[model samples]
Target: MSEVLESTTTELTPGVRVPLIGLGTWPMAGEEAAAAVSRAIANGYRHIDTAENYGNEEDVGEGIRRSGIARQDIFITTKFNRDWHSREGVLTAFERSAHRLGVDYLDLFLVHWPNPAQGRFVEACEGLRQLADDGAIRAWGVSNFKPAHLRHVLDAGLTVPVNQVQVDPARGQPDQLAFHRQHGITTGAYSPLGRNGDFMASPAITGPARELGRTPGQIVLRWHVQQGRIATPKSASDARQRQNLDVFGFELTQEQLAAINALETGGPPRLDSDTFGH
Candidate 1:
């Protein structure tokens, strides 16, 4: 399986594209992260999304090296940890990630969260800008950012081309998606399947899964891709990883798409950025 040819991509900028589907490695580390990444790569995954908070950068890098693919042939994205959200903190944190990943350059770097209470995310992105200019990073973005947070990044003079956030069956985030469209940023969904095992039980998702001859998860994942959002679903299993990437052969009807989207009930309030994290 040549994942390079089998996968599709979303444009992050002119001439720069990240795979529409990427292998997400969270809640995984050490040997576990290494095994999953190497297997995903061998089974046809060219893009991998990791984070400093995940504590598995070295494992991810080792997995990449084990895949026998050149660094340029793969698209890797990792985020700066929340502890290092300052301008200088970003540079130092990035250095740690790069060193751990054993790569001289990162395909994409993101501020892991917009902890507005900390008040340094804007400067973090500005530091990422300098990194991009210095050729230390290819592109930069933010994760878990809300509309107001995006404005801060933009106001700080950063033109981030991507924003990684939670957009699943139950968290469509229409307003945030609209904001992304208005500002020319692409939305990258962290979990295509809704949380709390709600993904499997949702008729909105399963109905389409049966009719379309795909898994419920596939229906939800495809929905995100069809709507032009980069969907990164995490699984430690190689089979599941490949299944997540194999959704281009079919699409959901507009009605099916809308129905699944209607499952959105504003998501859990805990996940809301206002009370999320510090």
Candidate 2:
């Protein structure tokens, strides 16, 4: 069945709006990844997320072509590693990624992580800002960045249009979310559903799933977008991909929303940005 799900967007700039739900391509490679991307675009997904670290930009580009969707109609996002954390290094990285993706311009490009120990993150942000101003990219951001790291970037007078972090009902980073709110940075939730189905059994999620007649995954993804946050959920199955993007047609009650928020266990994320980055 061919179905076009309505897309919802969050504005990162005056005119740039990112689709709230995106297809995340990670750990999937070669033709399988390409096929998945093609299927997702056909299923009404306008946003696609990839990273150099994922080693699938070439496949992703192939998938885009296979989808037969106009390049301008899709919002493509990709990230670079710490090695590209400099003014010139960032440009080089963008060129390489764009070339691999077979696109001359990108919708959004990001620093995959803040390698603070290297102390070049500030310069990296500078490079991203320059790219945005010159129209090489529509917008730029950082991922896995904590409040402390963001403060330094902010102090350096750089504009962070978005910050993609690991956020889910189980590991809700209230402090990090608050910091983003204070600084006007849009929160993009990677691993937004948590590891596996571990958190799906919580009453906070299951209760709403039962009440709303939706899957636990849908419940959690709805929670993210209802709060004006963006979520990129990875699913290779056609059925699962459709389910993930079919979150916009319903509304969750205040009680249900608060119940899900109450599931926070106050634990550290599986991957801490401080010590881990490529």
Candidate 3:
């Protein structure tokens, strides 16, 4: 309901700007996915995150068409599936995604996973660089990568503009975040609300939510934005999507932020390649 959430953007890297709070379209697809995206945009979401594996790019594109927002106004992102790491596979995969999304160029493109077992990371990174050179994607990044993997990209001379990972009130990634900040790389959080239940139930989030007179989701998202990381929350429900974007009106005091930061116990990350069969 706050207007602030509807109108905020963050410069992730030079020439790369994204809505600080975005709608994540993971499991939703088809007409349902399209409708949800359209509704979210109408309600004031300017960034949308999707992946080829999600099977919803076309639907997302349809929604964008319906939203009446200019193509230049929305920051759209999609990813290259790990299985498509071969040189040819990467190009073909992204082209397919772009075609389905009905967009000539993506605001950002990412390597979905490291897939070290496949031994195609360098090749994939090269392919991404080629795409960038050709202007097929405005920016390139990765998801679920550790410091070492990121360093490999850097050493290889691939300037990754952003890295999307899972960060929330319960699972804070301090070391990874510090590494990114040192390198001038932006971080994007996928489950910014800690997959919903965990975030809503955490004392770290609840205490702040109650003290600030805001929802736990808002508190968690504000934490990410205040930390300078981009946060994308997934929800098909219109009201919930709007609530996820309502993070800009309040400011977490330094003490409140520290309280949340202190909750970071260097806990185990909830996401791993094993879980996703990468």
Q: Which has the greatest lDDT? A: 2
Tally clashes: model 2. Answer: 0
lDDT of 1 by residue, 1-278 (tens): 35444347877866678888899998899888999989998888889999988889999999999889889989999998778877788889889999999999999999887888888788888888888888898888888889899998888667879998888877778888999999999999996675565656878888888888898888888899988898888888978987898898897889988898787777542377754653
Q: Please give, for residues 1-278, the per-residue lDDT of candidate 2 as tens digits.
A: 11222248888987888899999999899999999999999999999999999999999999999999999999999999988999999999999999999999999999998988998998999999999999999999999999999999999988788999999998999999999999999999999898784779988888889988999999999999989899999988999999999998888999989998888888877888898988
lDDT score of residue 113 within candidate 1: 77
Better of 1 and 3 by TM-score: 1
1 or 2, which is superior by lDDT? 2
Count of backbone collisions in candidate 1 = 0
Question: In candidate 2, where is summed lDDT lowest over 10 consecutive residues?
Answer: 1-10
Best by TM-score: 2
TM-score winner between 2 and 3, please give it: 2
- Listed per model in order, the count of residue pairs whose N, CA or C atoms clash below 3 Å is 0, 0, 0
lDDT of each: 0.85, 0.92, 0.83
Cα TM-score per model:
0.93, 0.97, 0.91
lDDT agreement of model 3 with the native: 0.83
